[model samples]
Target: MIKVGIVGGTGYTGVELLRLLALHPHAKVCAVTSRKEAGMRVDAMYPSLRGYTDVVFSTPEDAGLGECDVVFFATPNGIAMGEARALLDAGVRVIDLAADFRIGNVAEWEAWYGMRHASPELVAEAVYGLPEVNREAICGARLVANPGCYPTAVQLGFLPLIQSDAIALDSLIADCKSGVSGAGRKAEVSSLLAEAGDSFKAYGVAGHRHLPEIRQGLSRVAGEPVGLTFVPHLTPMIRGIHATLYARLVRDVDLQDVFESRYANERFVDVLPAGSHPETRSVRGGNLCRIAVHRPQGGDTVVVLSVIDNLVKGAAGQAVQNMNLMFGFAEDAGLGIVPLQP
Candidate 1:
């Protein structure tokens, strides 16, 4: 079994990893680190995970991550860079669920994130882990930088069109709404129940950090610079992301067939029936990403709507998928948990 260690295990993504790894057949969670809540039993902190993971949270200094085959950093943006090099040098692979190594350019990363990268030299070695697009690279990668939730939905919804030159690259706009949990497990005043419940508002319109990350991925597919306007909103729910991508159709082609043909064989991505609107609830707690296509009234405008469980497909589940690829196991191994449909 592949031993796994999770740094920052007190957060939403970290606990989600433990929840999923508990049932994973080929993996074992060995260590979980938390600087603030060290020495407390993980299950005592998260009663939902009781009996599944008995390991307690320890301080960062006490985490001997080299004991595990892979380590997942579910901490905030800048935390992973400080420890990634040391861990990888010790032959322990890393999968960062933060934004530390997602952007290819160090300057652009530093510009939006407001801090210089901690280990820029190792930036050359980290692979952007989007299983559908960069599967081959993730297989042998020692360090994998998992994509953000918004980027995951937007890119999957538009990648095929961009790759086929069916959509204009210069005029791309992605409007996405994510559950309150996407803000993280932190106690932010803005994410409180009163602030988020029954109220919806967009934040970081012009300069969201995920903007560069999305552009880098879409640009790679379009083979050109993809300038995009990405706006994200906070939803009332606890999980899931719904993204509506707008692009000008470069050619007069059936948008339905375009999406259908592209995702025909994809295991995790599904193109819903024509005229069908996908609900975020339909994919909650699962690794599935359900997307739909629409040719709006405007002749050149196409709207692509996609939904996914922000914590699952967007984070923990994707990390497990990467682990499976790295270990030569089934891509969907231990990740086939069906969506929780009520």
Candidate 2:
């Protein structure tokens, strides 16, 4: 079994890792670290994991992470970089589910995240963990940088268009809406139920942090710098991200066929039938991205709708998918969960 260690066991993503790994046939949770919640049974804090895990939260120093085969950092951005080097030197594979090493340029990451990168050299060595794009790289990577929630949905929506060179590169737009859980499990005035509930408004219109990461991924596919306008919104729900992407078609082609062929082999990306509208709830609690492509009145514009559970495909589930690839397990191992419905 692949022994696993998790850093920061209290947040949404942290418990999410615990919940998913509990079902993994070839993986085991060895340690879970939390400075504040040390000595507390993990199941006590999150009852959803009661019968699944018997591990208790411990301090990082006492976690014995060096002995684990792989360690997942589900903590805040700065925390992972400060400690990843030592773990890597111990020959343990590391997967960071934060923005620590997602961006290729350290200076750019610093400007947006508002902190000096602790391990800039490791940034280059870390593979971006978007399995659809970097599957081969992730397999051999000692350090994996998991993509953010918004980037995951947006990139998947625009990937086929960019790769086929079928869209006007300079005018790409991603209008996204995410549930409140995207804000993380924090006690902030903005995230309070009274504040975020019964409200649907757009934030980060000027420049969201995920903008550059999305641009970087698309630019790499298009082989050139693409102009993109990415705006994110907060919805009243608890999970999922719905990304409505727009790009002008540079040539005439079947939009449905393009998407279907592009994702036919990808088990997690579902291409809905033509003229179908995919709902966020359809992918809730599952590591799946449901997409639908359209052409308005046969115009030059093409629209693609993509939906994913922010905490699942957008975070923990995708991390597990990467671990599966790194360890040569089935890509869907432990992630074969049906979406939760009303």
Candidate 3:
């Protein structure tokens, strides 16, 4: 069994990882760290994990993480870079579910995340953990940087277009809306139910942190810098991200066939039938991105809709997928969950 250690096991992403790993056949939870919640049973804090995990939260110093086969940092951005190097040196594979090593340019990452990167040297070595884009790299990587929730949905939506050079690169747009859980399990006035509930508005219109990460990923895929307008909105729901992507066609190509053929073999990315509108709820609680393609009146503009459970495919589930690849397990081993429905 692959012994696993998790840092910052109190947040939504941490518990989501625990919940998913509990069902994984070849993985075992060896330790979970939380400075504030040390000594508390993980299952006690998150009852959903009650019968699945008996691991207790401990301080990072006492977690014995060096002995685990792999360690997942579900902590905030700055936390991972400060600690991943040590773990990697000890022969433990590291997966950071934060922005610490996602961006290739250190100065650019610092400007957006607003912190001096703790381990900039490792940034170049850390593989970006978007399985669809970096599967081979992740397989051989000792350190993996998991993509953010918004970037996951947006990049996946525009991937086929960019790869095929079918879209006007300079005019790409990602209009995304995500559930409240995307903010993380923290107390803030903006995230309060009283304030965010019953409201539909966009934030980070000027520029958001995920913008550069999305651009970086797409640019790498397109082999050139692509102009993109990424705007993210906070929805009233609790999970999932719906990204409505737009791009002008540079050439005539079957939009449906393009998306379908691109993701036909991908187990997690579902390309719905032509003219279908995928709902966020369809991917809720599962590591799946359901997409649909359309052309308005056979116009030059193409609209692609992509949906994913922000905490699942957008975060924890994708991390698990990377772990599976790194360790040579089935990609869908622990992620075969059916989406939750009303």
User: Among all windows of ten consecutive residues in candidate 3, which has the lowest summed lDDT?
Assistant: 43-52
Model 3 TM-score, 2 decimals: 0.99
RMSD of each: 1.1, 0.6, 0.6
- Report how far residue 340 has shifted in candidate 2, in Å: 0.6
Q: List TM-score per model, in order.
A: 0.98, 0.99, 0.99
Predicted candidate 3 versus true structure: per-residue lDDT over 1-342, tens digit per residue: 999999999999999999899989999999999999999999889988878989999999999999999999999879999999899989999999989999999999999999999899999999999999889999999999999999999999999998888999999999999999999998989999999999989999999999999999999999999999999999999998999999999899989999999999999999999999999989989999999999999999999999999999999999999999999999998999999996
Question: Any idea what lDDT model 2 has?
Answer: 0.95
After superposing candidate 3 on the true structure, give the runs of residues whose Cα lies further than 4 Å from its correct spot: none
lDDT of 1 at 267: 93
Model 1, 1-342: lDDT tens digits are 999999999899999999899999999998999888888999999999888988988887787788789999999999999999888888999999999999989999999999989999888888999998999999989999998999999999998888678888888999999999999998899989988899989999868989999999998987789879999998899999999999988788878888888889889999988888999999999998999998877578989999999998999999989989988989988898989978
Off by over 4 Å in 1: none
Could you tell me the C-alpha RMSD of candidate 2 in Å? 0.6
Scored against the true structure, residue 38 in model 1 reaches a CA lDDT of: 87
lDDT of each: 0.91, 0.95, 0.95
By summed lDDT, which 10 consecutive residues of candidate 2 come out lowest?
159-168
